[model samples]
Target: MKALTASSLTGLALLALTGCGESVSNRLMAPTDGPSATKAGTPIMRGLTSSAGVVPTAYDGNTSGDGSSSCSALGFGSTGTKVDGAYSQKVGGYQFTVSGSEKQYLAFAPSGTPTSTILAVIVKGGDAYDVYNYRNNPRTSDAGLTSPYNHGGNIPTISHYVVCYGPYTPPIFTKTLVGVMKEGATIGSMEDDLSWRDHPDLVIIPWGRTRWLDWQLSYTLPPGVTGIITENATTVCGSLGTFRLQCTFNENPATYPIYTWSGLSGQGAVLVMNDLGGGGAGSCGDHDYTNTATLALSNGTTLTASKTITVRVVCPTTP
Candidate 1:
C-alpha cells in the first residue's frame, strides 16, 4: 500500500468538496495575498456575499420615505422610533457612532425604486465613530455592488441616524498695511518732482477666509493736484469649504510692492496710481495723502481700512 502524503491528503479533501461547490475550505485554500485574500494569509469568507447573489448599493445624498424604512434596512431597530440625534449602532460588522445637534435620516435608492433602499444616517459638522464598510461586502466585487444593508433584495427596514450642524462662520480681513515712497534731493536740480510714478503702489492685507463682495476706494490728493489715475480694481473670491477673498492693485499690470515692518515681510495689497506728470521741480517737497478703502462681504458684513502715505521729491540749491 502507498503512503498518503500531506499534499495527497489535501488534494483528496479538495476533490471530496468539489461536489459541494465553493465552500469555506475552498476559500481557505486560496492564496494568502490576492484579490481573494483580505491581507497576507487572510482569505475572505464566502458568507460576506448573500446566498441569493444580490449586491449592495452605494450611499448618495438623496433621501426618501421619511428615512425610517431606509434606516431599518441597515438594522438600526424599528421604523417608528425617533432615530435622529446622537446615537451609536453596529451595522454590517462596523461600529458607528454619530453625534451632533441636527440629525437627518434618509433612504438612498441608488438603483431607483423597486430595488432595495439603503438607510443613511448623516451627522452634519459632527464626528462619526468607527464608520467603515464591511470586509465581505467590499465595494470592489460586482456581487457587492449595492450597499451592505440592502442585500439579497431583503429590505431589512433598518434606520440610519444623521446629525446636521449650523452654518459656517463669516469671512474677515486683518493685518493690513500701506506703502509710501520718499524722494531725496538731487545735485543742481531746481525743484523735486513728486509724482506717484516714483513710489510703489498701495498695499492691503487680508486675513481669514474672506470673500469681497464689494470694494470702493477714496483718496485725498495734495493742493493743486486735481485727481488721480488708478488702475481698475480687481478682486478674487471663491469658496474653500468657506469663503476666500483677495484683491490686487491693478488688473492689467498686477504690480504689488514688498515691505517689511516690525520684522515681518509680506506682499501687501496694492493700489496702482498712474503718474499725472504734476509737482514742479522746485516743488520737490513732501505731500500727505489719505486713502480710504471700504470692502463688503457676501455675508452682509462690511469692513473699512485706511492708510496715509507721503510722496516727496526735493530739489538742490546751486550757488
Candidate 2:
C-alpha cells in the first residue's frame, strides 16, 4: 500500500492506489501529542452516507459537557459490549482488533476534560483480566498475570476492552476514546484508511471515526456476492467489519498492516455488514443502500445517523 498525504490527491491519482492518511502508513503507524481539543460541530461527514440518514445528528445532550459523549475506539465498530461490576460504575466495552505485533500503549482520556484515572481492563478470556489505570498502568492484581505490560512485553491484542472513569460518578464515566499508542510515540492517531480502494472514483469515509467521526469509502462487487471472499480480479471481495464497535488488532502477526476489519469473526477488526449487496450490474446503475447506525457512546448518550451508500457491481465484459 502506497502511503500518500491528503494534499497529494490528484483527480483520482491517490485513489487509484491504496492511499492512506497521515496517521497510517506501511509498517509505520501515526500518533499525535495526545488528544486535541476539537470543535464539535455536526461531525463533517461529506461524500457518502454513514450516520443513519443524517450527516451527523448533533449531540442529543449538551455539546459542551461530556454528557452523551461517545466512547470512541477509533478503528472499532458501531456496537459495544456493556459491562458492570467492582471496577465499573458505568462500563462500555468492545473487543479490540490489534493491527500488528507491535506492543502499544493503550491511551484513554475524557472528552470534555482530560483525566488521568479511568478504569480500563483488557479481558483476555474467562475470569482472567488485565486491569490498570491508563496513564499509570501496572495495576495488575494477579501475581501470575503480568499486565500494564512493559512496552517491550507480550501484549494481548485480540481481547476485550472495557473503560470507565475511576471514582465513577454520574455521567462522564464512559465519555472517552480508547486509542492505541505505540511505545515512545506521542498520542492521537487516525484509524486505518477504511476507504475500499477498488474504485478510484468514489467518496465518503463511508464508515469510521476521524476526530472520532468524519470519514469516507467505496467499493465494487459482483452482483449478489457477499461475505469473506475475493473477486475475479483476485480482489479480496468481502469487507472485514466489526463484530462489535471494537478495533481488531492481531496480537500475533507475521506481516505489517496486520490490523484490518472483516466480516469473518476472529479474522480482522470488524465483520463486514452482510447486506451490502450489489444491485444488478453496470457502473452507471449503482444501487443505493443507506448505512445507518445508532451508538451508545461511553459518555452516556445514544446517537443515531443515516445516509445512503452506493453499491456498484459492474457487469463483466466478454474478452
Candidate 3:
C-alpha cells in the first residue's frame, strides 16, 4: 500500500531494496517529493473515505505497526465490515472509504455555535479503535507562511495550516483507529512529511456537526401553490408568546411527499394562512390541503421577498 504522501515512493523503495533499513541517505528529499521515497501506509499517510465520502485520518496521534495483525486489520467498505481492499462504511447516513495504514477514527464537535454534534466511528479488521474529538480548528490566519503545528518539533513544507478550535472531547464510540503502516513506511517519515506537508492541500477533516435539513432542496414556485410572505409577528393565536407565522404547501401526485417552509419559525410548526395580521406583508399560510407535500411550483406564481420575513409569534385572542 502507498503512504498518505506520494512523494516518498522512490527513496523508500530504494532503501527497502538495499536491505539497509533506517539509513540517513534514505531520508530527506525535495519538499514536494516528501522526506522518504517509499509507498507505505503510515498513520499520517493513510486516507479514509466513508461510504458517504472520503474523510481524513491524522497521524499526529496514531500508534500502530507496519503490517501487524492489528494494523492490517483495519479497512473501510460499504457494509462497515472488514474487506480485502480498503474498507468502506456508512455511519449516520454518511459513507466513508479508508486506505493506507495505522488508521484511527475520531468524532468532532461543531464550530463557534455549538447547537449540534457529529458522531463517527472508526473500524478495522480485527478490532475497533478509539474515537476522539476530531474537529477542533483553533487557528488564526497567518499571512500564509507560519506552520499551524509549532507544538511539535521540526516542521515540513506546508503552504498553510490551522489549529482546530474548542476543547478536546473523547469519542463516544468504542473503536480507536484501525490498520497498520505499510512496509517501509515509518512513523517518523509521516510526521515530517505526509501529516501536514502542504497545508494548502492538507484537507482538514471536520468531525463536527452536519446539517440535518437538506438545504439543497430549492425549487421554483409553482402556480396554484401560493407564496406567502410575512413581516415581524407578535401573536400566534393566543399562545401568549411572540413568534413568526408558519406556512405549508403541498405538491401534486403526492407520491414522494416532502415539506419545507419557515426558515425562521420554531422547528416543526404548522404555517398560518392568508395573513400576517398586525402590520405584516403579503399572504402566508398552509398551501397543501391534501396529506401530500409539494416541493415544486408551477409557473405564474409570485413569491414574496425572503428578506421581509421575521418569525415572532404572539397569542391570538380569536383562538
Instruction: Give the best candidate by TM-score.
Output: 1
The reply for model 3, stretches above 4 Å from the true place, is 1-43, 59-118, 125-259, 262-289, 294-319
Considering TM-score, where higher is better, how would the candidates rank from best to worst?
1, 3, 2
lDDT string for model 2 (50-153, tens) is 11221111111111112112233322222233332212222332222223333222332234423323333333312122332222221211112111211121
Residue range 1-319, candidate 1, lDDT tens digits:
9999988986775566444434435323332222232333333222223222432222322333344443344443333222333345433322344322322212211121111111223321111111122222212112211111211212122234431111122223332222222223554322222333344332111122111111233332211112222222321111111211222332335343321111111112334332211123333444443344444322122445544444233335458
Candidate 1 residue-pair clash tally: 28
Q: What do the candidate models score in CA lDDT, each in turn?
A: 0.29, 0.26, 0.24
The number of the candidate with the highest lDDT is 1
When summed lDDT is taken over every stretch of 10 residues in candidate 2, the lowest stretch is 42-51
Give the RMSD in angstroms, all C-alphas superposed, for model 2. 27.0
lDDT of 3 by residue, 1-319 (tens): 8555555865565455333322323222112322222224321222223323323333333223322222223331122222232334332222333322322222222233332122223322221122112223111111111111111112222211111222222111111111111112554332222322243221121122110110111233211222222322221122312222222212222422223343321112223221122222221221111111222112112232221112222223355
Q: Better model by lDDT, 2 or 3?
A: 2
Better of 1 and 3 by lDDT: 1
